[model samples]
Target chain A: MTAAPHPGRTRRTVVLAALLALLAVAMLAGVGLGAVPVGPADIVRAIGRALAGEARVPGDAVIVDIRLPRVVLAALVGACLASAGVLYQALFRNPLADPYILGMSAGAGLGAVIALTLTASATALRFGVVPAGAFLGAVLTIVFVVRLASLRGALDVTSLLLAGVAISYVLSAMTSFVMVFFRESMTSVVFWMMGGLTAASWPYVWMVTPMLLAGIAVPLLSTRELNLMLLGEDRAAELGVDVERFKRVILAAGAVLVAAAVAVSGLIGFVGLMTPHMVRLALGPDHRVLLPASALGGAVVMVLADLVARTVLAPVEIPVGIVTALVGGPFFVWLLVRRNGHR
Target chain B: MSVRLAYEAATVGYPGVEVVSSARLRVAAGEVVGLIGPNGAGKSTLLRAVTGSARISDGEVTLSGRSLAGLTPRERARRVGVVPQQVSATFSFTAREFVLMGRHPHLGRLQQLSAADTSLAEEVMARTDTLRLAEEPVDTLSGGDLQRLALAQALAQEPEVLLLDEATSHLDLNHRMQVLDLVRELADAGMAVLAVFHDLDLAARYSDRLAVVAGGALGEAAPPPAVLTAGMLSEVFRVRAVVGADPVTGAVSVTPVLREEAVPAAGLGSVLVIGGSGTAAALMRRLHLAGYAVSAGALNRGDVDQAVAAALGLEHVALPAFGEVDPRAEAAVARMAATADAVVVADVPFGRANLGNLRALAEVAPRVVFADGFRGERDFSGGEAARLAEGLAAAGALSVPGDIDSVLAALERFTAR
Candidate 1:
């Protein structure tokens, strides 16, 4: 059944529409602020010629081939991370939970590093090997964490986070122990963990978009069950929710989402933790609105962060993760100190 | 009417520990059954067993004669609704939104609540007096309001059987009566209601029958008068109490005479009182509350003294009000007089019709206290009452000032025997 509007949906509609508009402007600014400073008219003509299947204009190769792919890839990764955040938060029933709070990012990073160090080259079939290992490692770690955190049909929130942190420390130690043998791969691993969108290309965009769609779709379809779960698990069961199966499906979807984002961009922090929270504070915690709002907010924040990452230092190229942390950390602290609880 | 819910020879437990063993009870439509026991007496466990939260290791628990184990949760929910003892939640949903969840079992898996389902929720909320609280967050409401909301949600199920476990534990007097009245109204509407109550008096007042859980077993289910006997109350609850009839509703009532509050301190023994008007009513209550085995008699039935006796649960021997004094009633009074350790004759002036009461006092021997004026009014009907009074005084009956305090002193002096 369709949801009737709840408490000021008009304002939320205005907020969402503004986020999309801001994202459009940020994308244009990102494309326009390069070494050549491609103008709006240049972007329009380049796009017109490219879509018309005609010969490229002068700046067509720069805008259509280079910047657009990078922006699209950043949007996809951002949407995936934030959408996964909502799923994990609901699954654990903890507002502090995030996509990688349960060590999915650390496991994914370890998987990518192991693949990189073992291979003779980190390029050919590199994407396939690393993403598959990362996805497998992330999913397996989630399963183990879930088992450790559950007691007699209920999940314990404190134990789930503790298990995740414990596993993360051990996995990071294992990665380091292996890294001592391969110094060249170790440098690439560190570079990857810093996280950036500079490797943006059409292939990377193709790699993350489908997963982004999947991550958003899973929560969209299960919003009702998610609402049922907001009351404790037993109450949900008494009301006829198959809680175990619901948990498994949502957990797996969240693992895939974090695994996909981390595989390509390596451990981008704060977007998954902060985007959903910001959206939840602005709109209420109705997952129907909150999930999509988080996705859109994630996309906007990631694109703007990327815009700053590529341009602010002028060709030096800061990692997008650093830019996100620089913005998100202060805002997060402000939220915690300024507000007592949800109004 | 057919039984809507039944537990037959059921043994419910967790792991190796049995909580409710060999329980046999049935609740039929249009009945409210109260389950009561002392703390740790498995009252909640028996309730949980019925709800399927605990395992029924043996025998049968049925809903409408069909085994509960065979039905799906949603199917069972459609028939039985539980008003849980407490609900704690993190999401701040409004009361209306929370109450709407009761319709979940009736809705299709993917279908949302229809207009009809919503209107039904509104109706139940209004019935529970929670309509004004519809917009308030559930967590922000007071305990009583939350309880009302819980009732609304349970009623929204339109269930045939309702289970309540200590549902009134957190309520005050007004809300407690309101909740019991609601349960009665629901039962009257062809629903079976089983409630767990810690307040035995409240249970006795509202329940058609009571099932006592004690020593890990369920006692027989019987009407309040039979189940609330003083012997059973002391054995099951370890409290010294008197079982009486409610003056207004004629329901069973319990007056606990706490051991620390009474006879042990005063050293009073069993005292029987002869009272007709309202004169000895207060004295009878004071002696009974002081933990004496107190009984009053010789008052006409349906008179002030009899009504007071019924209210205080002070057992009394009564004659038909304003009728010829019957030999059978006199015989009953004489029989009760045989067991009295002491008897106090009230300051009532004797008439020909009531001459049997003073005559009955002849049977109480060791000590009898006559009020002061019995000698002055002893000349009625050629001094016949006067003759009975002098015989009592000759039998070592002490005369008091005929006031409340002096009569109590006279009774205390008799108790010293």
Candidate 2:
């Protein structure tokens, strides 16, 4: 057996480095451009002073207390959704499959709507219970979808997608029923569904950061295993993937990541779907580079989109989800249409 | 030598219905076993039973004398590899990454490929001649390339036992040879191989032993010549396919008497075809479907002509399998040929084994026709068969292509008289 060295090794590494640099630029832009116009020099000085044990530097409150938590939460949630997106795409062996294709978003939306209305008076309950309900709803929906999708020891794509779609509609209708009966809490519910990072505090950021890290770490370990799945589940099993066990574990891991992201950011639409799909198309589907690159790309995209949400039409905030959709929707359709034309 | 993979009286099934029943076969280290049978005859089911993919309801399948039932799939995969017909890919994976995944069973969770593992995958890619295409995306690969890549992945596993289900069916002539050569090399390297093949000739050329599955069970395992008898193919495929040795390579070759499924839509009345070796295989099929109740005579048993005759269900008096043209069989064939309204001597090779078929055709000369273009080529019996064919031609017998339209016209002429 000869080494037969990988010719693209150095080229891929260089590409990765460039992506990281882009992420850094995007993060800086996210922090620098805002309604108050905190320049890069002022932000640098504030960071330097804060490192030197000065908490009262110029723009210190805006940089540290107000905007910093939101920025960090945005990065963590983006990482969570993108990594989860990679896992879901690999698990189902479908390029079009996304994190929420299996009813995760629909289930979470139902839970958020319920929890928002139930605890209008209890502010602490709103913080904890809404995320908790969303997570529970996501887990339940996925479990049901898995059960309903598999037949005679095989998962049929048509059945899985159909089941997910049907379950989503039923759960959404139930959420709508609750909303119609209780109009008083509709405004908060709608705001949560629209999705934002504005409510991100230090506590909320800390609560989900560990979950996001787990999401990123688990897929990193299974990069090769996930690559095995691209060749279909039976082939993966023959190649020693313990395919049934792998499916369960990967799906659970992906759902956990989705729970953390949706719980924090409400329902940011396209970070999970667009980031991984676009990255795989541009770069090959080697999950080793893909996992980390997507993590960075997701983080970069989320941070930049949040900045737009923060500054656009100053003082009257639009949801970050709307911006991502407005960007992803047309681009996704164009990619598909162009691919079809080429074929 | 001890067997690495052995199935004993195994009845594999889905739910309650058995697909392969009571099959007994073995593959020792350094042996290649070719699995051949008609479609749905359980060749694949037998292979699947080894990996627990199919239920082995009534028999034992052991890897190195231990049942695979006790071993986990990963443990089993560590020792056995499968190359299925089509490997569907959902992503645009490079061929190298896809082949490297064959090492998964040998590594631990969270373990990267060791330098040794990478070397093995490289060796496998080189062996499959896929190194040049290693960086190509699998989704964009041609069928042959993807098939070769699948084989390379199986080889990268470096397992003691390998199972290939129609692995080379989609490959071009060059890649087909490459894959079969690689299979031989792997066998010589002490790997056991069980390959399901539709091409009997290729199977016989490569396999150390041939396992003929038929009638819901595997027949006796033996050398290719011993197991690939005309009787077996006739019973299994319901096609009269003759088995003979290649003139050059000397490998056993199985030629189905009639390969084309294009059974003629129009049925001519009955017509007689004089066939031997593989001369009348196509003619028999054409005559049968073009509305003639097709029959042929003096065909040696276990020959291509006999097999095709059997496959087409045409009534023909066949000689004994691989022996002399006995008086009783020759007389019966002559009688049948003589009584026919018209006989067409297919442009078959004239050898000592089938000189009697020509003699029978000579008896029906006034009613006989010869297929065009082999006017003098088939004279292996010194020219005795040729002289007889020329004498019949001198008697005003027709000579034509024996194609569907031509044969139908000849049948029409015979019926008109």
Candidate 3:
């Protein structure tokens, strides 16, 4: 309780400060930068004018209406993906695992594809299509993963990963087959497949932010259990962490986050895989630090990618997925090289 | 602070195979209970069952007359703490964090650490001599250090009853003694401790009561001298041995008698064995099976391996350990070694405190062979065995491989010799 410079508390303080600063910059840049090139002052003015019931800024209204929702949605999706990544990595006690390693994304994608195919004929279901499909897919995948992994008395991570990978590949192949069969709906499906925030609206932001916050907060509270799990399941159980129930809860929570993200913007890769690891390298392997940092770091990466996606061609657009792949691939290459050399 | 633990009609094992059945065990508070058994005796299974990590199958465990079945996890944890057989951490949590986990059962759901709980954890860590490691990662701990850390974690729980299953198996002699001393101190403080031990002498010296489990049944559950007798050991452990009180500590001491296989089928050569305890049993078994006429001496009859040699009807010359050597027994050993094709000395203990046995072996054998003891520590009597081994090696005696398989291979090499 003394305000003395304790090393542990000081380090946590420094890390929290740095993460806040990064998030602030990411938010500002996401609001200000776009093909229309609104400056930070005008962006602020437009937000204030809209709040003050004056709906007139030369091109500022377009930025708020179009780009702001997409940017906000990207941040929500990114935070969800990264925090879900943190949970899965800690739950399995494997550094290489990610949010989608549980098959939630592929299952969600398959469900979305089926919905799209069904909705093409029944045009009345246009608004209900993607989110409904994603939720159903996530719930189904979690059930399958849990059932397959349960052997003897408890669920195991190694078996869960194997089952997840098998189900994911099967679902992916089926999705590809469906895409080929319904070539007439190819453009709309391809847009979802490309992982863009183009369709993001204010209503979507309201839906996702609360879900992402819950995903982040729940896992943060259970950081100690995740730490115990790293000692192996039997040891964890001996130490009073209900190892079986913890696994079920974490898997369910991770699925909900990933399914919710895919519900808005189809599968976005690398954020889930890279952000937790990057945080671990910086903050050390404690889940209390790693989980929140992953959420903030994922938002930063996604927002930056969104800015480039909207502005790189200036009035011409590239899908945000292309920008994420472009940035994340080289970043991942450097990470792998540095990690390999370090070992 | 007295910890009374009881297990009644406890049946434990895998899904179908019951290893321990209907075993009733009771230990009064502040008593150090030792559970000793042979390799497959289900001692560990009973410990796990009591800890509630393993299912009870059909029985009940009670701490202080409270049924363990009815207690919540947190409630049970407050009464009992468990130290498992092996400690491994796949993630590197700082030692402080690791020990703090012991306070889990004491904390309410979603409750952060209270100031009192943190202080209790630190106090326990210091008492366990694990405070030095508080900031260090648990994964980076050495085996001894890790065991102590594990002890700290259990102690931090501040439970009334402590259960350790072979906790000292990975420790060295010094650390093992230190850890056992700590257990005694904890029991003195009025905590109940039920520990499973492998070393018989350590069990006898420290434990208030010893529980010997063998062949899936309780052999003896009494004070040391009564439980660790020669007859009980031979019947349960299948090794013939003498049991007596230690001169220094007044605790039970064991010396194995030689029990070889039957006399050689082809009489390839005569083997003169100068060894004691386990090394002699192994040497007797290997040499006799390899078709050698066996004769052994410089050991007492109550020594378990000597009984083994007697059972195989080997030409044995035994001597009593209490008084001066018998001149006739000495003469028989000399004659046996002189007539033999090879003389094999197993990794037997020889204290400078007792030099007559080594001098007699040295005088009789033209070729002296020795096997390495565990980790080459040379048992409790260190310098004397090494110097004797050095002399034998200089005199062109073969130093057989230290491990069991290698010992058999060395006998095959001797077949050609």
- By lDDT, who's the top model here? 2
Q: Find the candidate with the highest DockQ and give its number.
A: 2
Expressed as tens digits, the lDDT of each residue in B291-322 for candidate 1 is: 57878866777566665666556677666778
Better of 1 and 3 by TM-score: 3
Q: How do the predictions measure up, each by TM-score? A: 0.76, 0.85, 0.78
Candidate 2 residue-wise lDDT at B340: 74
Sorting all predicted structures by TM-score, with the top scorer first, yields 2, 3, 1
Ranking by lDDT: 2, 1, 3
Candidate 2, residues B1-417: lDDT per residue as tens digits?
Answer: 779998888789787889888888889999999999889888988877777667888878999888977888788888899999887765677788789888888888767677788778878999899998877878888888898889889888878999999999889998899899988988998999999989989989999999888778787778899988877776676665657798877999876654345456564455778777777777776667555777888777767778677767678777777655566666777788766778877777777776777776656777887776346677888888778877877877778884656755766777763
Reference-based lDDT, residue A322, model 2 = 91
Candidate scoring better on lDDT of 2 and 3: 2
lDDT by residue (B214-254, candidate 3, tens digit) is 76676547888888876777667776555766879988887
lDDT of 3 by residue, A276-301 (tens): 88888777787767777788888888
> Tens digits of per-residue lDDT for model 2 on A1-343?
2354554466668878987898777766777778777777777787678779876855787886777778878888888888888888788776556656677877877877777778878988876887777777887888888789985467777687778778878887888798888888877666766778888788888878877777667778888788888887768777877777878788777777888888878777768778998788788788888888888888888998998898888888899989988997787667668757965
Interface RMSD after interface superposition, model 3: 3.4
* Best-to-worst DockQ order: 2, 1, 3
TM-score of predicted structure 1: 0.76
Docking class of 1: acceptable
